[model samples]
Target: MSGLNAPISCDLLVRADAVVTQDAERRVLDDAAVAVRDGVVVEVGGRSGMEARYDPGQRLDLSGKMLLPGLVNAHTHLPMTLLRGFADDLPLMEWLEKHIWPVEFQLTEELLAVGARLGCAELIRTGCTAFLNGYLREYVTGQVVADCGLRAVLGEGFFSFPSPMFPSAEDCWKTVRDLDARFADNPRLRTAITPHAAFTVSPDHLAASFELAVELGVPWQIHLAESPSETAMCLEKYGKRPVELLHDSDLLGGRTTLHHCVDVTPDEIAILAETGTNVVHNPASNFKLCSGVAPVQAMLDAGVTVGLGTDGASSNNQLNMFRDMGLAALAGKVRADDASAMNAQAVLDMATLGSAKCLGWPELGRIEAGFPADIIALDLGSPNLMPVFNHVSHAVYAATGMEVCMTMVAGQVLYLYGNFRTMDIQSLKTEAGEAAKWVLAAAGK
Candidate 1:
């Protein structure tokens, strides 16, 4: 053991003007610092206290910045970055069947990886250190995420019908098994069981997938009640609403995340809370597609765990969690017709802690000691962030993703000042540009 007087060695010491600790107490410390060692936060306290106690290999002085835990994207299709702006102003089913699905079917494995890598760049740039992704060719997406040093839970979303990647429903399960095995020992990567949704995936398959997720002790995510049409279709086919179907099937639980619950009723909200099922609110995508706003305030009031997410770039047009955070705050107020609904701090919390809970990562989305050092810095020097009355307010209301100056995952700086430390941004952009052309042509867009 080291002597009492000796300064403990740490990998990095990050000092900022203020640290927003979204802990249970929601403490905001001024002139605070966080000490990281081996990807974990070893200490977090006043800057002078940290400086006096630890010797850091590297020091990051974010004097004009506010530090917060890195944002978590609870639900996203990372590979859909290639489909951004490819389809817009259409309903969810029309958007998917007429444009997104066709284009997705044409995406080669190489293109899928490229799109996922580009999405990772966007995520890192926008201060997201971790994401829960559902997409095709998820192994490729997982490898890209692993190489880029971001934490992710990747799942291959499958339907009752054969997909481009999987020839049969059985084949999809085999792929999930392979993914679970491949990422079993990885700290930064894992796999989820993602049956597409009630509309596209049969009840039997959804149950089987849920069982596999339970057997592997992994999260089970699926798109649910995204639009009115989905609810109508599910009710027409199964004599129950989407959430009710899942609840009846015993699929609603703490480890299950239902994305885009835009059409759920008050009863459904209560059901979600009672079952401990998590929901991801995708405000931007929902609005863009003309899907009614989710009953977020009702859900919150009923004690439902709600996380914020950018559904996919194809529909949302961006993967920036900050954008979604702002939208979630505003949409909730608009939906509830009360300005106090989904306040700035509440939305910010949804993006971080709530999203972490959705992913079943208890140790993530906080800046406390013993937590992973997944943190981000926002440059308070920006004009939009001027005269900051409240850091949390500015973070959720005023600051765009441009204010993010640094994004770190597990003590590793993946993005800083427009520079991606893990991936080649320029080359990836070029390849994505080419891929977009190919996708447009293939989709006859």
Candidate 2:
């Protein structure tokens, strides 16, 4: 306390039993406090040091809670919340071509908005403060995320064939441009160009989408090697693998985030590393769809930046990052036949800091001075999290998303003590149910 400054004023002071700063050093401080001002963390130190330095307008005493940076969901399809459990237990191609695509052809803007609302609510309750969303009608999704006080990169899906959202590929481009312009200046919402997949999109369309992404200076996302059938199709049609096709089209680079590289080869993994392209692993979704496990440990060994994702509620059946972390660790070990693979601390890093790097947000995913105050509190009093001997082990192996009692983004509490300050969760649930019913009926499902 000798080095502490004279008492200063700030917006909020959050004190907890332990502050798990997921920084480069991975330091976990005991009896810690963080002072936030203007949505930025001004200080993080011992409780006595912070209390001596700043006089806060509001103080939250989380005596029985553990503080950590909010989880970053690197990839998801938010509007698919309406389709959760609508179709399951099928191969990837059959699931998409027969059921998912047909229902998506019946989605209206209002229905899409309802689904986005539901997804936002679920993500907030589960300690996710930011996400990368790839789906249709992204403007609606962007608005919903903005209103819900969450940070997101919203992407509009593009395909060569006509769909319910757009009549032509040009129509999809127009929507992307419109969404980009609308959210260009927004602090909480950003835009991205998303082509459904390499196999589904024509070469010309993919080239145009990448050019547009470059022009807009935003990241581009695409599904790559999600299933064996997809890899087979790419090989049969293009005389190359999916990654080779993207590289040939000049689409593989630092600004690209490829989701589900479950079938990628060693050479492709090296290419991904050399080109600085990011990979997102959706373990639960892949396992559920029988798509085979992604070589996450191999990717990490190849120096590829890998992050964790839930894919979508439809495939994952939950928007919980805690479950994703656990599954990622377990799957990595099983896939590698080594208990040392994807240790608990590494999985936790993938959920927070690693995902932030994938999103190109340097100031997020850490609790430290000058970083954005994106934080969450987990109830340590929970029975499962009791007798915590190791912070990282407890967080990754034992604690579930239900233990997250409060979620804050940019120093603002969005959900606290089971109450949402920004959105109406009950109304969203009712509306989402209605929307799901309408879409199912429209598609005659």
Local distance difference test, each candidate: 0.91, 0.89
Candidate 1 residue-wise lDDT, 353-377, digit = tens: 9999888886788899999999999
Candidate 2 to truth, TM: 0.97
Candidate 2, RMSD to the unseen true structure: 1.8
The window of 10 residues in a row where model 1 has the poorest summed lDDT is 162-171
Supply candidate 2's per-residue lDDT for 85: 88
Residue pairs in clash, model 2? none
User: Who wins the TM-score comparison?
Assistant: 1
